[model samples]
Target: MKILTIVPAHNEESTLDSCINGIRNQTIETDILVVCDNCTDNTEQLAKSLEVNTLKTINNVHKKSGALNQALDKYLLDYDLILVQDADTIIDNRLLENAVKEINKDTKLGAVCSKAGIKDIMSSK
Candidate 1:
């Protein structure tokens, strides 16, 4: 199954490198789409340097949901599964593989929520 990961970024240069590296190191090959939404920073350049698929927008929607929706509308039909990932989140190499396995086994499973570390949660909040 083909999986597509959509990463919505806005002035996330500091974290984008790690995130892109993590995605590149995943055990399962995936088509990554990094949408640089109304960013004035070097986010697009960073993504391009990593050689990952990228898109840039100037709409200034300013919401992750809007960016995600734009990506979905553009590329949803091409992929079997769509992963909406945060720009700063670092994922395990086996993350997508494990999730796909579980999802395939149970068609009734509607959603899966990941548990974040306490420090991460606290910092984000």
Candidate 2:
């Protein structure tokens, strides 16, 4: 199955590297595309340096959703599964592998999702 990971980013330069690296290290090999949404930072440059496909949003006013919409519109028909990922979220290495496994088990499964885990700031203290 052809899987494409779309990362919607807006001035997320600080966290983009980790996010990209996490995607790259996924157990399931998939293509990565960074949707640069109205960014004023080095988000595009950073993504390019990481050697992944980059898509720049055109005057996106709806923020992350709009940015994702733009990318989905253009690339939706190309890939079997489209993974919409956050710019700063670092997913587990087995995420795609586990997700694909679940999808394959059930023919009715249209999508798979992982709930985000919040960092406990108090635990660090």
Candidate 3:
């Protein structure tokens, strides 16, 4: 099955690399689409450098949700499966495989989502 994972990003240059790496290391390879929205950083450059598909969002009024919607409306229907991943997220290696298994096991599965945990926390020293 052709799977497309959409990653909505805005000024997330620092975390983007990790996110991409995590995706790449997944057991089930997937096409990644990153929506770079109103980014002042080098997010687009980084994505392009990694050879990942990227779309620059012209409308940035509604935050990440708008960027996500822009991608979904224009390109969502082209794939058999879709995953909306955050820019700062680094998914576990088993996530894709596990999700696919669950989805395939049942015909009624419309979508599968995973829980996210904080990767880092900072405290004023």
Candidate 4:
């Protein structure tokens, strides 16, 4: 199954590389789409440097969700499934494999999500 992962980023220079690496290291083959939303930093450049499919968002008041929906509405409808990921989060390499396995086993599965143990969630809040 072809999985297309969309990463919504907004000035995520510090954590973007880690996130990208996490995706790249996934066990299953995946097409990654990184949406840079109103990024004033080097987020676009970083994604471009990696030579991954990248898109920039326009009219992004809703932030990450808006950027994500832009890709969802426009390009990337050929994949079997879509993974919504945050720019700063580093997901496990086994995430795609595990999620796909579970989803495939249960045909009625609408969505599969894993827990993100963000170390600074409290500090950010």
Candidate 5:
């Protein structure tokens, strides 16, 4: 199945790289697209440097939803599944692999979502 992961981001320069890397390292390979939502930071450049696809929102006023809508409008028909991932999140490597398994196991499955967790950045410091 063709899977595309859409990441909606603004000025997320601090967290975007990790999120992109986490998506790239997933057990199930997926195409990543970073929606640069009227960002005034290095988000677009960073995504480009990471070698992932990017879509810059033009005068988006609806924030996250609008960014997603733009990307969805362009990609909704191209892939079998589209994962809307948060820009600040670093997902587990097995997330896509496991999600795909569950989706395939049940034909009625509408969507698969993961539990969120807070990383101990203070402890690392």
Candidate 6:
């Protein structure tokens, strides 16, 4: 089973490295694709350094959704399962493995939402 992680990024050079690294460190081997949308930083360069596939777009449309759609159109055919992730989001190494195990066992899970947090939300108050 082939899995592809599509990360939609826009000027997320600082956090992108960590996000990609987290995916790379996973026990299971999966393809990683970073979609650089209207980026003004070195997001593309960093992704290239990681030797992961990258897609860049100059025109912005649906923010996260648009970038994901573009990636889906281009790379969806190559992967059996597609994981849509944010540029700044870092997931656990076992996330994909666990998800695949559960899916294979039950085959009834339509969706699963992972844990997420915003930076400095408590400090804002």
| Best lDDT among the predictions, by candidate number | 5
TM-score of each: 0.87, 0.92, 0.90, 0.89, 0.94, 0.85
| Model 2 TM-score, all chains together | 0.92
**Cα lDDT, all candidates:** 0.83, 0.91, 0.89, 0.87, 0.92, 0.83
Tens-place lDDT digits, model 6, residues 56-125: 9757678888888888888878887777788777788888887777667766775566666556423555
The most accurate candidate by TM-score is 5
Q: What lDDT, from 0 to 1, does candidate 1 have? A: 0.83
lDDT of 3 at 49: 94
Q: Could you tell me which 10 consecutive residues in candidate 6 have the lowest summed lDDT?
A: 116-125
Question: Which portions of model 4 show Cα errors greater than 4 Å?
Answer: 119-125
Of 5 and 6, the candidate ranking higher by lDDT: 5
Which residue window of length 10 is worst by lDDT in model 3? 116-125
Candidate 2 lDDT over residue span 1-125, tens digit each: 89999999999998899889989999988999999998999999999999999999997899988999999999999999988889888888998998899888988999988967866433565
Give stretches of model 6 more than 4 Å off: 117-125
Candidate 4, residues 1-125, lDDT tens digits: the string is: 88898999999888888888999999998888999999999999999998889999988899877898899998666888988888888788899999898888887888888976757633674
TM-score for candidate 3, residues paired by index = 0.90
**Candidate 5 overall Cα lDDT vs. reference?**
0.92
Q: What is the lDDT of residue 14 in candidate 4?
A: 80
Look at candidate 5 and give me any clashing residue pairs: none
Model 4's number of clashes is: 0
Q: Give the CA lDDT, 0 to 100, for residue 45 in model 3.
A: 99
Clashing pairs in 4: none
